[model samples]
Target: MAVQALKDYKFSPADAQEKFHGAQLLYVGWDEHLMFCAPFAYCLPPNTLFSDLCQKFMAHSFGYHPDWKSVDFSKVTWLKSGQPWQPDMSKTLAELGLKHKDVLRFQTPGLKGINGTCS
Candidate 1:
């Protein structure tokens, strides 16, 4: 799926300052059956990469997994509002319209495969 394009809104450093100070928080969890580890709270920074957050979540909560290396980043999905959340890893949290206490679910790359197909 394609990532959402930026809207016609204008952004300035002053606007960024307000958002930075009032940054939101998020809850991230693995999909069902991979729920052994507890979900963690994240301070949603304006410029945090989704992939970086995923790596941090896996390492901190579940320790090392052999299958991580073979996983495809593009196939990873973050869901909110029944849609993929920010499919582009390079996009920042602010760009994706993420909000306070937003709950997100991630489907691991290799676990579900793209469109449920075995890769």
Candidate 2:
């Protein structure tokens, strides 16, 4: 349901890209992993390489999960903003067409949380 404003509302969004200096806002999530509860938000430079993002940022964010060790990037299914995506690990986020506030979700095949409970 769309929200209808009872009165004229005009204001800038606090989370706009410009508010983060040169960094862009990115959201990443692991599918069927409820341990995280929600996606992780990151403020990073657009020039950050996809490989670095996964090896560094994602590792730090989701590394504690039991399934993290089993995740194989080659076999994982990736989705960008809810659509299927095949990212070039060698390319930077900007080269991959990822913009501020974009969401990247990855689902590891044969892995669905600990004991397949989606926890």
Pairs with backbone N, CA or C atoms under 3 Å apart (clashes), candidate 1: none
* 2-116 per-residue lDDT for model 1 (tens digits): 5566875545655333564666677776664243455567765757776666666555654444445555557766788557765566666666667666777767744642344
Please give me the total number of clashing residue pairs in predicted model 1.
0
Cα-based lDDT at residue 86, candidate 2 = 97
Residue pairs that clash (backbone atoms under 3 angstroms), model 2: none
Give the distance in Å from residue 100's predicted Cα in candidate 2 to where it truly belongs.
0.6
Which RMSD does model 1 reach against the true structure? 11.5
- How high is the CA lDDT of each candidate model? 0.60, 0.93
lDDT for residue 114 in candidate 2, whole number 0-100:
77
Predicted structure with the largest TM-score when compared to the true one: 2
Judge candidate 2 at residue 98 and give its lDDT: 96
TM-scores of all candidate predictions against the true structure: 0.56, 0.90
Model 2 per-residue lDDT tens digits across residues 1-119:
55589987678899998889999999999999999999999999999999999999999999999899988988888999899999999999999999999999999978888788998
Predictions: Cα RMSD each: 11.5, 2.2
For candidate 2, what is the lDDT?
Answer: 0.93
